[model samples]
Target: MKVKSFKYLLTSISVLILVYHLINMFIFWPEIPERIAIHFTKGEPDNWGLKYFLLVIPLIGLFLWWLIGLLTKHPEKLNYINLTEKNREKQYTMAKEIMILMQNLLFIISIFANESLLRYAAGMENGVFIFLSLFLLAVILISLFFNLIWAATLKE
Candidate 1:
């Protein structure tokens, strides 16, 4: 797919994921315990809070989605170590792509975290939550690493 189209696709998917998370939370709200597990360590719940605290997850996700979208609108404001007149446009495009990719991955992570929290609240163990979280984090870091490298090496 073309670059612009790909970016839009990612943005669309991110929006969809956020919506799904919010709806899921709403649908399952009644089932959550009065005091739910809000934090986890090593796949185990460590911190607990009122079930209403669960709203924070999707709210944060929504805020981040909006913030990232706004930030990408002014790519000129993005910092680039090797930005120059000749390569300025190319670098800006790369920076925006990186931001979009990060946003998408973050949304996915947020959904997973929400699911993990809900499961914990229900007194269930999701053994794979930690592993999946780590894997997604690694993917984000690696993608950023390579995208930055590519942006740095861009020619006029």
Candidate 2:
């Protein structure tokens, strides 16, 4: 696939994962909704702190994408986005990798955290967990290849 199309697909996948995570937080992690209300003095570890941190990965990935669009304008059929510098490409690629890694971690967690997601659908027993884990694992594997590809392509 072309770089642009691949990036679009990745963006879509990342967004979906992020949304799923957010919804999971609401459904399973009671600590999530009580975040701001949670008192540090209560001595409770931040509720679902890792999930919150995981959520930041995709947000940062989006920010990097938006930055690349704003800074570089090289696509032949460029829309409102632009990416003129090589560093921007590298940065975006790095952010994408980080996002994928974060997602894979969350996917694994969801498999075990039944309250976060119903693993069993139709009595299949956490079918979504099984499927999502596989999907996220595939994404992570592909991302490793892309990481090498981007590194090679961006070489001066």
Candidate 3:
């Protein structure tokens, strides 16, 4: 996909996920206990805190979305080991694409985490959350590696 179109798609998905999270928070708020799971070990709650702490995930997601959007607009400011006059534009485009992908994946992760927290608070298991987390992490790492290699090895 073209960078512009891909960026727009990511933005739309992020916004939708954010809105969904907000709605879920509102719907689930009444059912959440005074104290909820804030941390997990072996898929079990290990740390507990006030339900309000759940807001942190969505807030972090918003901040990251904005920061990544800013970075996407100015990829030239990003550090690069292979930057040169011949490859600058291509590298910048690649960087922007990578930033956009990362932002989307991270936003999804944040939403999943928030949902997992809610589920845990309701005494539910999060096996799917754990699996999705691992899968997304692999995707992010693999995409980063290949995209960097492609940019670094660019000709003309």
Candidate 4:
């Protein structure tokens, strides 16, 4: 897909995720526990906070989308890991792809966390917790691995 289309897809998905959280927060506010799990350690919920703290997920997602848009709008502002006169264009393309992928991944992780916390608050089983955690780690690791390899292949 074209970069512009991919950017739009990311933005669209982010907005949809935010809307889902907001709607669910409002509809289920009364059902959520007084204190909800806000942090986890070793795959277990640890830190706790008021249920309303769930808003942080959508807020952070919004911030990530904005940051991604800013970066995509001005790729020149980003630092390159292997920038060179001959490889600059290819390197910048890779950087932009990384930014886009990161933006999407971060938003997805935030959404998963929000859903997991909401489930816990409602006294429901945390079914997605492990999957979400693993997915987030995998995306970051794979993105880094591929991007670095791609950068290495660029003409110097």
- CA-lDDT, candidates in order: 0.77, 0.46, 0.83, 0.78
Candidate 3 colliding pairs:
none
Candidate 3 local lDDT, 33-141, one digit each (tens): 9999798787667898999889988888878877887898889889886678988888888898999999888888888888888877766676787678678878999
**Candidate 2 residue spans exceeding 4 A from truth:** 1-89, 104-124
Name model 1 segments beyond 4 Å from true.
Answer: 128-130
Q: Can you tell me which runs of candidate 3 are displaced by over 4 Å? A: none
Residue 76, candidate 4: alpha-carbon lDDT = 84
Instruction: Write one digit per residue (lDDT tens) for candidate 1, span 5-98.
Output: 8788987876786677678677777788799878767756688899887778777877887788777778887778777898887787877887
Please provide TM-scores, in order, for all candidate models, with all chains considered together. Answer: 0.84, 0.33, 0.90, 0.84
For each of the candidates, the C-alpha root-mean-square deviation to the true structure, in angstroms, is 2.3, 10.2, 1.8, 2.3
lDDT of 4 by residue, 93-132 (tens): 7778778878887877777778778877887776776497
- In order of listing, the candidates' clash counts read 0, 8, 0, 0
Name the better of 2 and 3 by lDDT.
Answer: 3
Whole-structure CA lDDT of model 1 = 0.77
- Regarding lDDT, does 1 or 4 come out ahead? 4
User: For residues 23-83, what per-residue lDDT tens digits would candidate 2 score against the true structure?
Assistant: 7645554433323321123333343333344344445545655554543334233221234
**For this target, which candidate reaches the highest TM-score against the unseen true structure?**
3
Provide the lDDT at 98 for model 3: 93
Cα deviation of 91, candidate 3, in Å: 0.9
Candidate 3 residue 119 Cα shift, in angstroms, is 1.3
